[model samples]
Target: MFAKTTTSLFTLALAALSAQAIITPTSPDSNTVVKVGEKINALWTVDSTDNWNDVEIQLMTGDNLQMVPLATVATGIDGTKVASYSFDAPDVSPYSKIYFLQFTNGGATTNVTWTTRFTIAGADGSTTEPENSTVYSGQTVQWGTGTLLSSVTTDGSSNSTSSSNSTSDATSGGASASTASTSVSMSDSASSSDSSTSATSESSTSASASGSRTAAGASAASASASSSNSNSGAGQVTVGLGMVGVASLVGLIMAL
Candidate 1:
């Protein structure tokens, strides 16, 4: 009886860890925001974890309605290993997007999303940044929906907004970021949430953009609306947009 009980407990613990199915790309996260029509190269670490399945990079842009599978590989190093993935620049346009890594092995599945950002341009485009929040279009950030730790970790505390606009950062699908307390500091299950958040922050800082502010907002809103359903945690956190910039632009625009 003792033996059986111990085995059961061990099995349960393993299952808990296994429940976290994922394909976490360690590079090119959403926290960073880039301009339109520029070369968008995303580097990610793919780890599908369950007995080897197809590892893939799924890029969702033009606000979720557009999904393109940039890369995939079947054979891997082991049940848990690291592999680098790079997605070539997408078609030029003025839009925002999000990204995620997926792992599928028969009946099992796992996914990890970065707090990232992206942008496409119509012309040479331009990035209009407000010098001060008090100015018109001077950085009036709008938050949206998507309930969860994203708010807490992203901003240290979760924030919510009433704006129904698709671009509201709180919404699920796109670049609109929801506000959180800015207190937590991406400290969840390290390998999963916490680590991903940190990686996203590094990427967001390097993002280079060139274009109009209004254009960015419109694109972000459209993506958020389209991504509303497909994404599990949609429109929950109310991250301020203009008043404050995104905390971390994850590797590849995990937000879009």
Candidate 2:
């Protein structure tokens, strides 16, 4: 009977140990910033004999004093006492919010949660302070929808006007540049035409001089030919007269 009673007490103690789950975070302290999807280690303790074969680790965040599960961590192991897990944070909005880890057994008993008030930085580890209201207070209040709408409209109109002015300035500058380029091209073309015209005039003047010289040379040759023809006629007439005179002298000799 004593053995049975001792065994019952030991079993009760073991059950109590299995019913409780404790988790403590060693990284990302209170009011500290940690990047989303950053790996962090956590320490947990659980009952070993209870065979609490599973435990789901989750990131908890929310407002109104009610924390909600934001992300779940796949630790991939049965809950073990004094074990460490590298938890990858979720990619959530950067806010100065209460971040915590919740370790719960697989329907074995009540769970344990540890809260760490932390800020979520950017992916590049760049930190930004939370809004003024969210900095010190836990409650989050936002501006009214109508006020936001009016501000957005005003900003949009101003941006549109600025963009239109910039575009107009750019277009005007481009047009001025195009006009300058066209003027330069026209000037070049005119210069080329003037050079062509001068060359043609010079060529024409050379042709005219050559033609005059040819005509003058032809006239001189014709004059020389006329003079030669007249000389030849006079010589022929003189020879005929000499032949007649010789024949008359021979007749006189014969008569004598």
Candidate 3:
């Protein structure tokens, strides 16, 4: 009787061990939103044991025995070493729907695990309406309101590119304005210099002509008066030229 009891106890223990799941899905939780034709990774943690040697990853809907397979993600994956699989989401007609992933062991006894429900959006950003059902099935899946994939990822990059282009254009415009301003200033300086030189030349010529006239008029009267007039005229010309030089120097300083 004791041997029979021991055998029954061992059988129960084996059944309990077989009932335990070997794969625990960690990604695509209830809040996940994926788009059709987009690549996604199925990640999970392995409860390493001799119960399973290989796994089959599948996209599924429904709950428990009513679970429906939507797509096969991978097959015959080494369960002990591989913890993640990458695959593109298949294009399903009426692509907007809520779904989950199922991991099934390929061992002698099937051990299954499932991820939480997630939304799959269509190319137009449409999604399945949120329902009150907590269990994920084909028609009755629960999701949050407005749980659609955002366009920010693609729009943000385009906005960044536009901003960079605008900045570059502004910089180029500023450089051109500076160049034009410098050219105008140089031209003004040149014109001022030309005017100063012309004024000095005119003043010297007028003074020389006045001196000659005064010397000639005084010579008819007295030699001493002629010499005094000539000296006075020369001093006036020197003072006028000095004033022009000072004015030009001031203008250069102001321009700088």
Give the number of the best model, judged by TM-score: 3
Comparing 1 with 2 on TM-score, the higher-scoring candidate is 2
Candidate 2 accuracy as lDDT: 0.61
Give the range of the ten consecutive residues with the poorest summed lDDT in model 1. Answer: 147-156
Clashing pairs in 3: none
Residue runs of model 1 more than 4 Å from their true location after superposition: 1-7, 35-39, 45-49, 62-82, 97-115, 121-256
Candidate 2 lands at a TM-score of 0.38
State the lDDT of candidate 1 residue by residue for 6-43, as single tens digits: 99999999897777655454445545444433334444
Instruction: Sort the predicted structures by TM-score, highest score first.
Output: 3, 2, 1
All candidates: TM-score: 0.32, 0.38, 0.44
Every candidate's lDDT: 0.41, 0.61, 0.70
Higher-ranked by lDDT: 1 or 2 = 2
| Model 2 spans > 4 angstroms off | 1-166
Q: For model 3, how big is the CA root-mean-square deviation?
A: 22.9
- Residue lDDT tens for model 2, 147-232: 01011112224466999999999999999999999999999999999999999999999999999999999999999999899999
